[model samples]
Target: MELRVEGLACRRGEAVVLRDVGFVLAPGEALILRGPNGAGKTTMLRALAGLTPPVAGTISAPQEAMAYGAHADGLKAQLTVAENLTFWAAAFGTSGIGPAVAAFDLGALLDRRTADLSAGQKRRASLARMVLTGRPIWLLDEPTVSLDAANVARFAAAVSTHLEAGGSALIATHIDLGLAETRVLDVTQFAARAAARREADPFAEAIE
Candidate 1:
């Protein structure tokens, strides 16, 4: 399986942050999206995940085959760790939460409510849900947020295992996740200057 993006463009509200971006992610491969802050890394990830529609071009991948993890750890605050994993298990059409539980080291925190867990614990729980999704393509935004060095190593191992299983990952992060064999997409060239142009001349559109 593969994800192909051609002439992709992304907009946040009235501002266009990305334009004419293109990339291909092949099976058993990983792509790291690198850019300075506000350079549209998150926007690109969201567009690839089908959460936000591209203003131009195409993402040639079935929506169901992609699993997305955003900056926010999307957990039900009141639900216990195990319950959260279980909910995602059924939602993503996958069974058996044991592997997911062990994947993120959630054994001890399983019975605890998400609201009661620390930042790292909650982040792990959120990531464990992705394992349950069983999707081939993982679109992660700042996936290593709040994780300690040891936990980061665990995440790297999980990603390695997924790749070995013929899965692909597209991660947008500031810190290195220790993925040695990965492609890098620097989005600086794709940054849309239209937003700044519009700011300089509000009436520029009508005159042109």
Candidate 2:
């Protein structure tokens, strides 16, 4: 699997968040997107996931890709953990939820309501839904949020296994996720790119 973004830019109304951003991730490779608050990290992830359209440039990815946002998207507050997993499995065109349940250590929480689970448990359950997708590429935004050290380790292991199986990931996070050989991109660089473009603009130079 491969994901490539070339000269990508995104805007929310009048504000340009990500500008001229580009990168590539090959199979078994992972890239970590790092930026401070309001630096367009989430925007870039959403663009990559196709949840948000880029204002300029292109995102090239496989047909079967999945994305998990900062929120635990799969956990239904009103549903039991098992039911939540079941619902996601069916949605992802899978036949069984057993593997995802066991992989994420959600066995005990299966019968419990999603609302009853703690924050970390909810995050794990959400991750299980991503796993059930069986997609080759994963776009994760803050995947380790609310996870303890032990669960973080478990999450790292899961990601390692996924990469070993020819899967790829692009993770946007402020926390260290312990993924091996992960590349880091600082979105602040986009500002520099934009400035350079402005400096080279004939109209801007004339105005100055």
| lDDT of every model, 2 decimals | 0.88, 0.80
Clash-forming residue pairs, model 2: none
**Every model's TM-score:** 0.91, 0.89
Give candidate 1's whole-model lDDT. 0.88
Model 1 has a clash total of: 0
Question: Against the correct fold, how does model 1 do in TM-score?
Answer: 0.91
lDDT of 1 at 109: 96
- In candidate 1 the C-alpha lDDT for residue 108 amounts to 95
Candidate 2 error regions (>4 Å): 192-208
How would you encode candidate 1's per-residue C-alpha lDDT over 1-208 as one tens digit per residue? Answer: 8999998889887878898888899999999999998899998888888788889989888989999999899899999998888989999888789988888898999999999999999999999888899999999998999999999888888888889899999998877877756998998868778544656897876797
Q: In model 2, which range of ten residues has the least summed lDDT?
A: 63-72
- The parts of candidate 1 lying over 4 Å away from their true place are 194-208
Superposed by TM-score, candidate 1 places the C-alpha of residue 92 at a distance from the truth, in angstroms, of 0.8
Query: What lDDT, from 0 to 1, does candidate 2 have?
Result: 0.80
The all-Cα superposition gives candidate 2 an RMSD in Å to the true structure of 3.5
